[model samples]
Target: MSKPTALIKFKAKLSRPATPKGAAWTFLVLPAVASAKLPTRSMVTVEGSFAGQPFQATLEPDGQGSHWLKIDNVLREAAGVAAGDSVALEIAPVEKEPEPKVPADLRKALASNADAKATWADITPVARRDWIHWITSGKKAETRGKRIAAACDKLACGKRNACCFDRSGMYSKGSMGAPEAAE
Candidate 1:
């Protein structure tokens, strides 16, 4: 029997910028900036079949284009090649768009947080989940907040993920079982 080695590159896309449902058509035509240097990375769309399952690993450039993409968790899991299996790779560059920026106010609060850990304990489970999703999305903790002041402000202002969250110390959906929900 011959040992298998070398997965293949499949469908690859330089993750286009995040777009609202309405602006999608316009975004399709945005010009690409050559300096993004998307080609220098060694891994593009790694095409191959893994564990009888066909899959493609994608290389998405981080927002700050100073290096290769963040960890390609999809490929790592797709291709069972691990431990001693030697592997080969191929790569290419495409004009990719940056993901749309999250709303400034929500981004600011999430970015400027300072009480993440302790804040969760006091909030409801739903609120806790919101905080978790907000914090975990980032790749680095240094880029996260340690306090909830910023989140609280957004909540006070009724922002969503990219907007302000409604605070009032009351769950807007009445999930917290406030007087409003009982009536």
Candidate 2:
């Protein structure tokens, strides 16, 4: 679908993640009301402006039913924004979903299984993204490995989606959301 003619606009202060202790990510949590206007609670791509600097990004769920926008170094520098600075944003969902890059491990697994690889190729980009997200969302190495194995098994069985996977992070007690503000 075409992006709405009018973009959804809001203002928020930048913040950092609480874990990792010294993470450099800068992100903003969208107001729940604004987030409700999006197509889905799961990850969604949008073209927008950050502090008036144009950008495009895939927004991630905040685990509390909202969304967070991450500002990469390039966008951060271009927007001239820093943590604690309130910035204006205007975004609209993109018409087409972008393909997610497959992780190396998942790539290797898919390569080894022809049936899984065929199903992976047959699925939609959004479905593939969901599979990738479900696999990568695992915080522990063992968890990720299990997810890759499960994904391959499901794909080999001709599963088109990550069944029962909670892409929004709302139903799952997982790491999702903007990083806590650093003191």
Q: Candidate 1, residue 142: CA error in Å?
A: 9.0
Candidate models: Cα lDDT each: 0.34, 0.88
- Overlapping backbone residue pairs in candidate 2 total 1
Pairs with steric clashes in candidate 2: 17-179
TM-score of each: 0.24, 0.93
Give the Å error, residue 6, model 2.
Answer: 3.5
Angstrom error at residue 159, model 2: 0.3
lDDT of 1 at 157: 51
* RMSD of candidates 1 onward, in order: 19.1, 1.6
